[model samples]
Target chain A: MRARLLEATVELLVEKGFSGTTTTLVSERAGVSRGAQLHHFPTKNDLVVAAVAHLTERRGEELAERAAELPTGSQRTRAVIQMLGDHFAGPVFTAALELWVAARTDAALLEAVAPLERVLGRETHVMTVELLGADESQPGVRELIQATLDLVRGLGLASTLGDDTRRRRKILDQWALTLDVALDKEKQ
Target chain B: MRARLLEATVELLVEKGFSGTTTTLVSERAGVSRGAQLHHFPTKNDLVVAAVAHLTERRGEELAERAAELPTGSQRTRAVIQMLGDHFAGPVFTAALELWVAARTDAALLEAVAPLERVLGRETHVMTVELLGADESQPGVRELIQATLDLVRGLGLASTLGDDTRRRRKILDQWALTLDVALDKEKQ
Candidate 1:
């Protein structure tokens, strides 16, 4: 029931945004009773905040699951970037985007979301380094990793407006080649 | 009075978001009479949409004005990237972000803001090509330009969470170097 409610909350957040989401809507979508919903989450804030945490954990797990399957050798950099591009363009990112924008004006949301976001961000960075097998101790390597994340994230924003897949693919491919040179992954 | 109302709308959009912004708040902030505000914008939709268009034009003009001051030769690429970084991290970008997130769930706003966004995106792309003085006729050049824009825009998103300026600078500087190599600008 808790899982269903949280899943419903995420869907509402993506579909209707923070303002448009409510306990009633979540309860209906989750097929859980209003009383049960209220018992679990006393307020909209508590519900949405818990949902974000749920989403963050799912993102981390998804990243790990995907990372386990990543290819090694010369294709790894491009493959890693491709993996990230898809991750950012998916539902988790869109759902998180809603909370992020709402958090800009809602201080309580900000307090709740900020630290989790930082952890997710740091983890993503570390994972990217490992997946690419790049040495951060090398000059310019760390920034390149950061750049790859930012590039995919920006591409994610473009996807929000419409299907930016074709253009995004080209950009990501180009970035992959650049990363290969910067990190010397080709020689590896 | 129209300009004042539009300005106030943008300010409120940045500070309070679209749902929190109302004609009453705009009028109060602009110091315009309720009658004048209503006359200029009959609905909140009309007011906010107009403000976005207003904001888009300002972004274009600001880009031009800043573009004129950009230095030539070796430092130019880095300068251009830095300029774009600043532009995306400022109040205008924050104001636009609120609309972008709101427009996700708002069909009416999506209908209104989409075209302006497309036009602005195209112009920004064209402007970036010219500023970097790159030959898009060459392969990969176009994608590199797109990558640069996406990178800074992602950096802009990062800034919204907290003061990411220092880390953003390192990434941009690294990107400028990568761009220089990709565009073969250093050889030129």
Candidate 2:
């Protein structure tokens, strides 16, 4: 029941945004009793914070599974970028976007979401590093990896507005080639 | 009075976000009468959209001025990155972020803002190309410039949440160096 409610919350957040989402709407979507929802989450903040955390964990697992399939090399680099593009274009990003926007004005949401964001950020960075088999100790390599992450994120932001998929793919390919050059230099 | 009201809207959009930004607040902050505010922009959508377009044009001018100061070469590349970092961290980005969030659910605002976003995006890309003296006709050069823009934007999104200044600086510096290598190859 709690999981259903959280799922409903994520759906509402992605579709309606923070301003449009309501407790009654969440209960209706989840098919949970209003009394039960109130008992479980006393406030909207409680419900939203829980929903975001749940979504993050599920998405993290999905990312890990996706990462496990790629073999390390330039191909893995390309795959990782594609995977990130998919992740950013999907429901997870939409839900998170809502939280990020809401958090700007809501202090409690910011407090709840910030640590989760940090965790997710750190985890994603680590996953990227591992997938690329990057040596963080290498002076330029760590920053290059960070740059790739930042670039993908920026592309993801563009995707939120409309389909920038074709342009994004072109950029990702170019970026992958650039990374290959940088990685080759590191080997030398 | 119009300028003041628009400025107030930008300030409220940044601090309070879309939902919190109201005509009453904008009027109070601008020290303009409610009647005058409504006269200029009868609806909140009209007010916010106008403010964003106004802000984008002003910021575009500011970018051009900043670009002119940097000497052409790798130094210009580094400077452009730093300039972009500054732009992303400032009011322009904050105001834009507010509009982006609001536009997700508001079709009317999306219609108003989408063309503006496209224009801004294209202008920024062109500015970066000129700043870097990048040859867009060259095969990989245009894509690299796009990648840089995308990366800076992604970093900007991170900045909205909290201070990532140090990390952003490092990524910018590393990316600058990477671009140098790529540009050098293009010459060969």
By DockQ, the best candidate is 1
lDDT of 1: 0.88
- Per-prediction TM-score of chain B? 0.95, 0.94
Please name the candidate that would achieve the greatest TM-score relative to the true structure.
Answer: 1
What is the C-alpha lDDT profile of model 2 across B65-176, one tens digit per residue? 8777876644767787899888988888988988987798889989998998988888888887877777889888888988888888888888889857898899899998
List of clashing residue pairs for candidate 2: none
The residue-level lDDT of candidate 1 at A120 comes to 81
Off by over 4 Å in 1: none
Q: List the residue pairs that clash in candidate 1.
A: none
DockQ of 1: 0.84
Best by lDDT: 1
